[model samples]
Structure formats: C-alpha cells, structure tokens
Target: MDETKIAQLRNQSIPPARHFIDGAQVSASDGGTMPVTSPIDGAELTTLARGTHKDADRAIAAARGAFDDGRWSGLAPAARKKILLAWASLIEAHALELAVLGVRDNGTEIGMAFKAEPLSAAGTIRFYAEACDKIFGEIAPTSPGALGLVHKQPVGVVGAIVPWNFPLMIGAWKLAPALAAGCTMVMKPAETASLSLLRLAELGHEAGLPAGVFNVITGEGPVVGAALAQSHDVDALVFTGSGATGRKLMEAAARSNLKRVYLELGGKSPNIVFADAPDLNEAAKVSAAGIFRNSGQVCIAGSRLLVERSIYDSFLEKFAAQAKAMRVGDPLDPATHAGAINSESQLARNLAFVDAARAAGRRVVTGGTRILEQTGGTYMAPTIVADVTQDDPIVQNEVFGPVATVQPFDTEAEAIALANGTTLGLAAGVWTRDLSRAHRMVARLRAGVVHVNTYGGADITVPMGGMKQSGNGHDKSLHAFEKYLDLKTAWIKL
Candidate 1:
C-alpha cells in the first residue's frame, strides 16, 4: 500500500488484543476473536477477543470470589469512595481517546461525541463516587427496649449489557453505581460498539480496581449476552436496548436464577407543541435538534411531533425547513450536524420506515431520501413527515433514525391523548407558554420525564427511567444506586 493508504488503514485500525479479567489483560480461552468495524464506513477497526461461555463462567467465578472474599464489600465506605474516585480520575485521563473510538464505532458526530460522551461518563462516575459515602443505614424507632435498623448492602456480581448507541455513557451508568456500592461486575458491550467498553476496563485496572471487580466480554447478544443473563453466578443484570431484547433478557434471567433485571428500553416519545407556544421558531429548532441530534438513534428521540391544529401548518413548515438545512456528512467534520446512520443495517431500517410512511399515505415534507454521495458512510437526510394518524406504524414504533412523524390535534386533550398513545413511555416534551398547561401535561403524561418548552434535555442529577413497556429502574442521579444495592432490616429484642 502507498503511504496515504497505509495511514488511512492505521487510522482505522484499533490496537492489539486487550481484555481485562481478574485485573489482567489476557486472550480468550479458546483463542477466538471478533473484528470491530467502523459504522461510518466498512473499515475494520480492531479485533476484540470473542469471549465464550467458559470466559463468562470464569468472569462470574472471579466476581463471586471478590464479593465473597470481602476485599471490596468488606472495605470501609471511605476506602470504597477513594477507589471509585481514583477510577473516575483515570477515566478522565483517557476520555478523549475513548470518545474518538465511540464516534468511529457508532458513527456519532465526533465533535458532539467529544463533548457529550466523556462529560456524560465522567459526570455519572463522579456523581456515584460522591454518593458512596452518603448512602447511610437508617435506625428505625422501636418500642422501649427493642431495637431495629435497616441497612443497604451491595448486590454482588452485576452483569451489565450495554447498547451500541452511547456505549461509553451507558456503560458508565451501570459501572459507576455498581462499583460505588462495592459490587463486582461483568459487562457485555454491543458487538457493534465494544471497543470503548473494553478500553474502559484497561483504565479501570490502571485506577487500581480489584481483580475481577470489573470484567468486559465482547460477543453477540445470543452468545455472550445470553450467557451473562442466564448465569446463576450473576446476581443482577442491567441492560439498555430494544424492548424486545429487554424482554428476552428478563425471561432468561427468570429461567436461570431469578436474578434482578433492570432495563431501559425503546421510546417513541412525543414532542407536543401547542398554539400558545412562546417562541415558535425556538420550539421548532429545539424539536428538530432533539430528533436529529443523534440521527434520531437515541432511545428517547422525540420522534412523534404533535402540534396543535391552530399552529400545525406553520409549525410543520418551519420544522421541515430547519431539518432540510441540516448538514449530513463525515462524522469527524465539526460543521456536520447530522452524521452517518450507525451502520448499513440502520440505514436500511431507516429507509424502510420512510417507505412505510409514504405507503401509509403520510406526507414527506422534506428529506425522504438517503445521501450516498456523502463519502462511504451511511447518511440519511433528516426527514419530516405529516398527516400521520395515531394508529400509524411510524407513530407507534421506535423508528430509531432521523425520521420524525408529525400529527395535528384540535384540543389540549387531543394533544395529550396523542402524546400518551404509545406503548413506550420513556419521555415526552411540551412547548407552550401557559404554565398551567405545561404542569397539567406533565402530570397527565405517562412518561417518566417531561421537558417544558424543550425536548430531550437531561441532567446527571435527575432520576431518568420509564413506566410500562419502556422498562423499569432509573439510570442517573442518586436514586440510581438503589438498583445495585439490597436493603435489609435487622430486628432485635431486648
């Protein structure tokens, strides 16, 4: 190869085999490996160890050993706090490199990845690190001579299954709290984006996390993921992915050992814009950003845009115009607003949603096509569709791409009804000047999160989760630690 070709290859390929088990880097037991591919283009990024069931067994055994051996869980709260903080600091040192790997593997815009991914990961880690010392046991009031107390203890051997999108952030969400609670864990990253998670294990070792306290095994969901879910040694499984996959994992956990299963699933969240919205232009822009920011690949993408009939036409016009102007190109470009779809399969899936919407008589206001001219990366223009009914597939299902379906409602009640019409209730957004209406909508909406005059706005300090089919448990804030710990009540008679 020419020097330019060699440089391109070098830029695309990841480093040699690195897998952390028992606080050491080792090859897979069976000498198997899987090649990591860049979602932006068809480039081989790296070869990760294709972990097997035996590896899963060994990882689980190691975690069980750590937990039972009492090296971590037995430590004082102050000591655990110190270790977690050190881990956070080490992660910060490698944040930029990890962010670059995430962008390359998942096709996220590099600039946005650099800003959001690392901050999201580090903020979550720091939040949980500080929380380590604050989690206190309560002394219950008891009759004269009797005594009662309640304490929270770490749930041992957490098996975390993270999705391809926002791999680093979600992995941190699961890891930070578990580590803070003094729980050992085995993590499984999506086959499409496992590089960053593996890299995290290396950093964790550098930060002095105990052997088997944090292990990452990379493989397909059916193999490695199922093994983790079904392993009797695993005490709990935390997952972020599609609702169907979540259900399957739950079933596996039930059949195996009845382990605790916490999930954050898919969403078809609504962004409701009323006629009384304070700033139509601003609302339209925020709405567009929420849906197009991650190429609509986010689980909480505001894919269903419900507009009040009084301003429906004008809102659609503005939203469509803004979406059409988005720049879809290389993810590394700072000016690129909408980057490549994560993979070819994702691009195909997105195009199918557009075709289905058209066939269902929905109107495509702009950008119902793919951009093959935009390098070898999979690029789809930000799409806006109107005339969609509540029963339409686009409105009901998680499109998970840069496609937003718009519908008009005649009344506040109708808007609220349409907003809560999906099986998934992860999040919802409202744009209105009326404080009373915003509060009322927030109250009535079934979603766990509601954003007023905004969409997809989130903070690390807030509890984030959903009800119904959107799955159980929260992933952020102080409340998140509850998922990794078990509470026990002690009663004594005097």
Candidate 2:
C-alpha cells in the first residue's frame, strides 16, 4: 500500500478494544490485557482485555438473564429475522474495516479477507436470517384418538467457541442460527483472531439486538473458555478447532451441566485424481487450492492427494510446479497469494511436521522450508511431498498448512481405500469424467462432503461439517439450526 493510505489507516484511531458483554464494552475484572501482535510484520496491533473466569461468569449471567427475561427469546421469529438481517447489513457496511482487521490480526491475504471472509460472513448471517420464519414444526395424527405436535424451540444459552482461521465466517456459522432460533449466546472467538468478532458484537448492539442477547469474552481457553464450558447455566456448547481441545471441552461440559456439545474439528481430506479425469491441469489447480488457499489453514483442506498410478508421476510434477509458484509475502500486499502462518507456534508446528515427514523418509517434491525471513513475518512456501503411503503420519494426521502429500493407487478400490485410510472423513475430492465412477466414489467415500470435480466449492446454503474424528454436528444450512434447537412433542388426546 502507499504511504498515504497507510498513514490514514493508522490515524483512524480505532477505540481501544475490550470485551463486549451485556451490550457494552467493558474492561477485564483484573485490568489484565494480552498483547495482540500482527503476524504480517510482527508489529504490535493492540492489546485486548484478557478475560478471566469472572468475565465468563458475567457474560453467561447476562445471556441467562436475557433468555430467562424473554427479552430476546420472547421476540417473534419474524422480529428476530428482521434484527438479524439488519445485523448482516451492518456487517456489509463495515466490510472493509472488518476485512482489514482480519488481515492485520490473522495474517490472511488482504484481498481474500477483504472480499471473501467479511462478505461471506455477511451473506451467512443473511442466509440464516432468511430461515428464521421459514422453520416449520410438524403435526401428526396418532393411531387412535390422539394428535402429536412436534414443537421446535431454542436450546437456550449457547456457548460458541470458533477458531482463528476464518473467525468472521465460522463465527457466523454458529451465531446466526443461534440468534435466529431465539437462543442467546456467549461466544468466545479464538484469541488469535478475536478483533472482528468483538467488532461484530458491537454491530449486534447497533443492529438493535437486545442487551445480553449476544456477548463476547476474549482470552485463552483455560480461563474464559473453560468457564463457559463448565458453566451450569450454558445450555449447549459449540466448538470448531482441534480434537484435543474439543475433548477437554466435552469433559468440562460432561462434568458440569452436561450441556449439549457440538464440535467441528480437524481433517486430512483426500483429493483423488483418476487417469481419465478431464483437464489434468484444472484438477491439479484445484488440488493446489485445496491446500494452498489460506495457506492450508482450513479444517477440511485436502492435504492428501491420491492419484491413479498412471497419472501419479505426471500429476505430482504439475502439482509441485504449481505449489512452487505460489507467491509468499506481506499480508497487506494485494498481489500476494500466501501470507504468514497465523502465529509463531503454528509456524513452528508446520515446520516440525515437515521435519518429521523428512525424517520418516518421504521425498519432498517442492517446498519444505520457511521463506521471507527478513520481514520478521512467518512465511512458508507451499510444500508437496511424494511417496506418501496410506500409513504415513502426514497422511493420517491433519497438517493444517500448505503441505500436500501425493500417493498413487492402482484401481477404484485402491483409491477408495487410500482415501478412506484416515480416521477423518470431513471432505474429499474426486476427479474423473466417468459419471458412474463419480457416483461410485461418492457413495464409497466416508466423507460428509465429496467434491466431484472441484475440491472446495460450497456456499452457506449447503451444510458443512465432518464425520468421525473431524467431529460432529453440521455448521451451515438449515440442518445447522437443529443443533441449537430442541424438539418438544406434545400429545393431545381427544
């Protein structure tokens, strides 16, 4: 960016951010704050209030009060729908600021964040808002003299914890439906990328949402997050992150209120290419997108590539060249396609996985080392590894980076076996022109979403989530509404 633009952005003096609770921004109880550093050039962006257990308690109490008081929950579905649509409009109005905030805070590519993340978040809110008044409860006749009515109602207080990669987008996946269903929520966005959501909570209030209907607490998981999970008042907990943390949250929920726990965890999804695939170059490009896009921070990234033996060597060559060509630089650069790994720890973890893969005797096809060392930013070139086996740790584990492992299979059966080798069944991609083969692969693959030609092309209308260790509960579409709602069947005897 030009110096003049940079100066203007810096002079914009965004108010010092704090926790949004009970419809207001408040300081942490202990006056504690955590330094939020920019991953772009390692600049200190700002300091955020470090919420503690007390903050969580206050937020939950506010949510509980709002729900019990029927201030938000008592509103008609049409009213909530109107309020949520206004919230979406507010997000769209502030898209540029929110996108820039995400870029500075999370180190995502500015262009991608500017158009994709914030805009998509606004669209999501709008989509779910449209569903509010359309939700239908069913009525059925009993065998004899009774009638059964299935009434769908909110799950009460929902505690949502979204990750850092696409905080605005994924946060919408949780918040929109919860709000539309008349469930008040206390959300804890990943501390690494909490700014936009805090700003979002402020927008919620601006959109005329009731006080305490939506709240945000900023801190690490152990303190504020665990407080939400362990709170007896929180009716349900929704999370999207690593499985290890998900287990802890589940245990906390089980130990306390036994609240309904919904999780969307990690994945090692497969991108299978057959010999008869139309346009090998296109397939190769999408395969690159499955991992290279967002620096492979996506949970359902197709990190494992299973190519037919006939196309194995050829596909690897094309994929490696594409991976090697990905531009890595400053996040704010519009031309830059790849940016810094979100954090130092994440960069370390990504590099460690490469080191382990090398030690395990896998041949590195392209990138395996860090780049842009002088900028003080955490940057890495897209990496591709050949000779990956079904049992390789890189294939079995979720390497949430720009790392793709290629393996060759003999037949359709072999491809299916290799793709389904891991415990994760979040997503997979099949590249073949044969209609029968596509259908066959789709049916056999144990994934929640199977892409026929494209690797990752989805919208807010389509339900997204995973099977097996990738965690349960859908995140998008009308199905996601079910997670935040409970069904009550009333039997009327005549």
Candidate 3:
C-alpha cells in the first residue's frame, strides 16, 4: 500500500526539515514549524520552518556577504568545478533516497521520480560543472593602440524559486550553472515540497559547498518568496511557476533592485496528430503519455490534443483506450502511471477544471473523477474530454491535471493556427509522416520548444523556455548559464 511506503520512510532515520542559512540548519525565529505532509497517504513526514520575510532576509544577507567576500565567486573555475562535481556525485549516489522523498512529498509517481528527479538533477549539476572551467572570455582588436577584452562573471546573489512539481530537479537546473558561474544563491523551494531541498542543502554542506554559497528558506509565496524577490541584494531572480505569479515577480524585481528576472511559466500546449503520421498507433500512445505524464502537472504537457478531422474518431478511440488502461494509484507503486496531486488545493483546482469542462457539455470519454480515496492520497484518474472547441475555457486554460481536451482539425495550417492560439508558447508536439508538413509545423509554432512526432521530452543538453506570456529567458543547457553571468568589457591603451 502507498501508506506502507510512507511508514517505511518514517521508519528510516530521515532528518528533520529546517532552514539552512550560512551553512547551519536552524529553526524559524520563533521555532515555528509547518507540517511536511505526504500526499501519498496524508501522513506527516516531518515539520519545517514556516519561513517568513525575516528568514528570506537572513538568507539574502548571507548570500550577499558570500558574493562580496568572493569566497565562492572569486575561486578559480577549476576549484569551483571540483566542489560542484563532488556535490553532483553525492547526489547521484543518493538518487533513490531523493526520489522517494520527492514522491512522498511532491506526489510525483515513485516510478517517474526514481528515473527523473535525482538522476536528472545530478546530470544537470555535472553538465554545468564540466562547463565551469570551460567558460571563456574574448579579446577584441581595438582601434590603433587599444585592446578590448570581454569577460563573463557571475551575477551575484541569485534568488531562485523552484516549483513544487519538480522542486529538486528544477532547483538543480538553477543551482548547477549559478554555482558553476561562482554565484551564490538563496533558494526558495515550494512550500508543498521542501524536504528534498533541505536535504540537498545538507548534502551540499557535506560535499564542502561553502556555507552561504547555497541557502534555503521555505514558506508561503507571499512572504518568503516575495521578500526574496523584492530584496535589493539579490542580483538576479529565476523562477519556474505560474504565468500570473511570474508577472508579479517581474514587477517585484523591478520595484526592488531592478534585478534581472528569468521565468519559465505556464502553458496550454497542443499535440497535433495528422492522418499520415509515421505510426498512428505509436503517435496516439506517445501523445497520451505526454498529457498523462506526471498527471499532467508539467508546464509543457500536451493538454490540447488536435487530431486531423479525417482520422479524428479513430485516433480518439486509440488515445482514450490507452489512457484508460493506465493504472492510477499509489505513488509508490511502480506500475502506477499517475500518482497523487501535490496537495489538497492542487487537487481541488484540478477537479474544478474537469467539472467545468463536463458542465460545458464536452464529452468525458473517460476519467473525470477522483480515485484511490482509500489511500487518502490526492489523485484523479486520467481524464480525456472530446468535442471541445478552441474557444472553450477547458481548451484555452491549463487544467494542470491528468486531463486533456480533444479537437479536430482538417489541415496543417489550421493545426498550426489552433496550436498557437494560446498566450503561452512553452511547448507543443506534432505527429506526421509528411516531412514538409513536419518542418512547416515546427517553423510556424510559436512555442519556445517543439517536438516533431513526439512530445514533452527534453534533456539537460537542450534549452527549455517559452515566449509570449510564458515569460523570458531559458533554463537547462548552456544557454541557462547566460542568465547567471554578466558580461564585462575592459579597455586598455598601450
């Protein structure tokens, strides 16, 4: 049982969650604590500080002092690389521990977390670690007797706020490059998922990451997160969350130090299927996997499925059957394709969208209700809605659940038009055997990342971001390093 897994974690000597500031694990100012509950069975794993603006202040101060002292920032790239690589290695070794904690806390399926979270995080850390010593500067030939040199330096005091769905992995996405670039960071892990982050802080300390080089404070978004975003000492703020929240963060950044802000926000991405797809059965299967993956909690989920009108009925048939066959149960179950929603609030929000769509007269082909009520784990079955129009709210808005809306399109141009209809340009996917049509779709889609004949798959080597309301800048890959570093030019006259 999923509850059994929760008990297993409890039986182990799991450390208590606490604030890590200046390399010390401490409690809230008043010793106040917030219960860290497992969505797996609504069990309280441990309690962490209900971090406040004051907590944010403490972390920021430490970060600023670290950056100014240059203990981390001033180190040779190779030295920094060594510390970061060791940190990555330790994380890899503890990958399973991290994954189990994530599944227990974040409601990510244990099956997926085991493969995705800690390993990906470790990979991300190493990728950037390898790049630390390789970052180079350039010399420009100046006019007459002058020399101009351009250099890249770490932007000091980055404030990173990671999302609840993939807190540890996304934190690594921000942490790796920022640390490699010699920047100190005060990380704000999502309140729903802070245990892994706290553990990460502990692991980093064990790996000899200098005190204050990495810090963590956990609290509600309005308090600790806002304070961090509004801090004048923070040079840059990077976030992965809702577009609505991203807009507010941008404003806060402007209001504070006019610091740089990078965001990877929400999406209502589309997955289009044409009649002549390379393998229609495989296309349907993969697309179902896309939206249904992570219970559709991912920002780049193919929430809107647009099938060619000619093959609409048959494709929907295949997709609906495939989705229904997916087992929905305990996060700890390896066979469970979908797990719990992160929290009660998130579960309610997901259910509301499904209900609203059903009320709008869209056909619920399968799975529009909560399941696994016995486990007390927050869960919803894989939901597929058909006959939804582009203008419908269900089609236009991001449901953020194991839910998808289906529509039919006749032509490639129509498919592109429908896919780009949303304000988000985060991600989209197309399935087709026509090479020209595939190229056309990729070139025309407004999303920052597109998958041809596939969906929702990107590695550490590729850049991930969005356009329009999806926010600015990129995360993952070498491009992410750009946000953490500042360019400086020096001129000399001989």
Candidate 4:
C-alpha cells in the first residue's frame, strides 16, 4: 500500500472487458460494446461487451451442459473443495491488484475496497470451500420395517445478478456457495461494475475450475438479467439490488419455469440512541461511519437515526461533526475518508433527496451539496437533515448515498415506532447501556440484523437479508447455503 505503488496501479492500463462464457473470454455475439466511465475522474476506464439474450443463452447452455455432463457437479466434495481453496488463494495473491482495479472501476476508496472487495471475497470463497466437504445428509426414523433417508444436493445451474456497490464481495456471496454446493453458475455483474467480476471469473478458471462451471456475462440488466431469470435451464436465480428490480425478477421467475429467486434488496435501516447509552461519543462516531462509509452506498447503512429528546442536541452535534470532519476526495488517495459517488446519475438522485427536503422546510444541519466539480468526478458531501418527520421522503426512501435523517423521540416506545415506520427493514442498531431495553429492541425491530451498541461490521458468519419491501432470502452465512441447495427424501422398505 505504498503511496507510489498505489498511484502506479491507479494509472495502470486496464484492458477492455469481455464476457467469460464457457471458460473462455469472448465478445458479444453481435460485437456490441459499451463504454465504462470512471466515477473517480470521469475518464473512460474501459469497454464491456454489450451482451444480449443470445449471449445469455450461450452461457446458460454452457452451464447446463457442464452440469448435466457432471463435469463439476459430479466431482467429489473434497476435490471441489481443493479447487475452490486454490481459487481463494489466487484471489489473495492478487488482492491488491484486484482492489485497485475495483476502485478504478467503481470509485470505492482503496482503503475500504482493498479489504471489502478482494480480501473479503477471498475469505468468503475460503469459508464456503471449507464447508462443502463438511455438509452432510440426514436420516429419518421410521417404523421397524421401514427406513427413511434425506439427502442434500446441489440445485443445478444458478443465475446471479449483483449490483455495482462491492461487486466482488457480493458476487462471492452467491458464487462460492453455489459452486461449493456442486452447482454451475452464470453471473451477470451490474453494467456499471463488471470488470472486477470478469477478472474474478478468469481467476477462478486459472485455479482449475472446469470450463463452463462458472461463467460471467456482462451487459445491460434488461437483456442479460431477463434472459437469466426466464431461462428454464436455470434452476435458481440470485440477485442483490433495488426492490423494484427484485419484484421484476420474481415475476420473471413465475412467468418462466418458476425458478426459485433469492433476492437481497435495499434497506432504510434505523439507528436508535437512548439517553443511557454506554458512550455517546463512540455511538456518534460509529453511527456516522456506518451511514457515510463507501459514500453511504451500503445496503445495511443506518440511514435513519433516532435519538432520545434529552440527549438529542448533544448527539446531533457529535454526529454532524463526524460527517463534516470526513475527508472527501479521490478514491485512490489513502487520506480520503469518503470516496466519489458511483455515478453522476446516482449523485443527482442523492442531491434531489436533499433538495426536496430543503424545499419542504427541513433543517439542513450540515453538508448537503455537491463538491469537487472541478475534478469532473461525481461527489456529494455527507449530508445530515435534522428535525425530519416520519413522513419525510428523506426518512422513508433509500438514498443509497451519504445522506442521513435525524429525528428525536420522547420515549422508547416512540423510538421503536419511528425506527420501524419504514416499509423496508434490512438492518437496525440500538445504542443503550440498559441490557433489558437492548434485548427488547432486538426482539421488536423487524430487521434481519440488529446491532446492539454497535453499527455495521457484521461479518460473514451471520445471515444478512431483509423483510417487507426490502426483499427476501439471506446472504453471508451457512444459512446462505439453503438457497443453493435442495433437500430430497428417500423411503425404503425392508
């Protein structure tokens, strides 16, 4: 991570991206391509193949052929584990290169992307690799003359669509488990962030993954994503994106072969602070970091903050100070605390939320404007809007940027109501020294993951998902295996 080396990698030339289908890099069938512009400096980074339904069909056929022929699915569990471990090691070896490439592609700060993108992906692959051999079938008790057995098997070809934010990390969450469970895969990374994943699949092949066992197709979601969702050859579909897209994928599944679709969608998570919190300063720091890190592109970010009326003013001061003190600059710069927003359109969307709140007579407490326009990169100052009501659009919608809404509540009951007011519940946080209240909040908050006295930093050991409009299905744990696997029952008579 030397400053000079970082610059060198940043300036390194990245080749045009191509689809990795059937174990070989190929162009779109129609020779179509799309320009990929860097959000860091507004430079054209590279071009990606503009894949169409034909490309999707080609990849699907490859995966289907590989699975039906048992090239990957028929492998011994230990053998699959060995190859996957090799893939993880290769990923670790190129961790820095991959991290820098991802930053250049998606504008995530190197400090965060280095760990969150490549290193985290390496660990996830390693985790699932080690678990493949350990997974077991079951036996069921029956009458004396009868014997019953239960078996767990790979669900066959998997189709995954991951978003631009943290592509490598989220891609592995789907790829590793499916591959380890003996399923072949065809993945489509977001149009804006397909380079890292294309490179990742190449590494997988280099680590001895069989041809067609893992394929990646890059293109517009409407074409590639729809093709995958509706492909009857695909046994299941996994996605991590917005709620509207999730609903569309579900509908496509129903209209097709009823392919099981697993979605990890958006969130408007709440972070509540009680007067008797352990340390108000620490809570403020963590809460600010939770929402603002990665330019608040995190799906589980604590976007809505609720504080007790008694300590509301003091806590808001600390939180706003934290947001203001963060350095927003080039993602490649190690000194930067926050990076560029992913794209110009996304930055405009974030600012619109702030503008609407300002016009609605809400207090723009701190940092709610665009900055660094001279650099030609899309950047937004971390924004905090205080005195926000439950009905505020900023409070209800998922901005997916470094924007947060603050509100004060008089009692724990009111705090709970405000926290749970949104239809989306992916994650929540409670800061309090009262153990009883902590447990009660955990029980009542309708979120998949609730952080007590902490925010964010939930490792891959637990499940991460959402309830309500936030979408369904879990990611990041052994629980994730449930989606890629199928259970079968066998009855025997003596």
lDDT of 3 by residue, 1-494 (tens): 25475447635655567899999997888778888888888888778798877888999999999889999998999999898889889998887778888887888888788767888888888999999999999999779799899999999999999999988788999999999999999999998899888888889989989899999998889988899889999999999998888889999998989999999888999899999988988998999889887888888899999999999999999999999988877877777888888888888888888788889888999998888878877888899999988888888887788899999998888998999998888998989888988888889999998899888777999998898888899999999999999999999997
Off by more than 4 A, model 4: none
Decide which is better by lDDT, 3 or 4.
4
lDDT of each: 0.85, 0.89, 0.88, 0.94
| Residue 252 lDDT, candidate 1, scale 0-100 | 97
Report the candidate with higher TM-score, 3 versus 4. Answer: 4
How well does each candidate superpose onto the true structure, as a TM-score?
Answer: 0.96, 0.97, 0.97, 0.99
Q: What's the distance in Å from true for residue 90, model 2?
A: 0.9
Clashing pairs in 3: none
Candidate with top TM-score is 4
lDDT of 1 by residue, 1-494 (tens): 13343234337556755557788876778889888767677677778888888888888888899988988888887888887788778777766677777777888886677667766787788888888988999999889798898989999999999988888888888999998998999998888888788888887778777888898887778888899999999999999998888989999999999999999997899999988999999999989999998788888889999998888899899998889878877776667797778888888988898899899888999887888544666888899989988888888889899999999999989888888888999999999899998899999999989999888767788988997799999998888898999999999988
Residue 306 of model 3 has an lDDT of 95
Cα lDDT over the full model 3: 0.88
lDDT tens digits, residue span 86-201, model 4: 99999999988898888888889889999999999999999999999999998887888977888999999999999999999999999999999999999999988898899999
The segments of candidate 3 whose C-alpha lies over 4 angstroms from its true place after superposition are 1-7, 10-15
Q: What RMSD does each model have against the real structure?
A: 2.9, 1.7, 1.9, 0.7
Residue pair clashes in candidate 4: none
Best by lDDT: 4
Higher-lDDT candidate of 2 and 3? 2
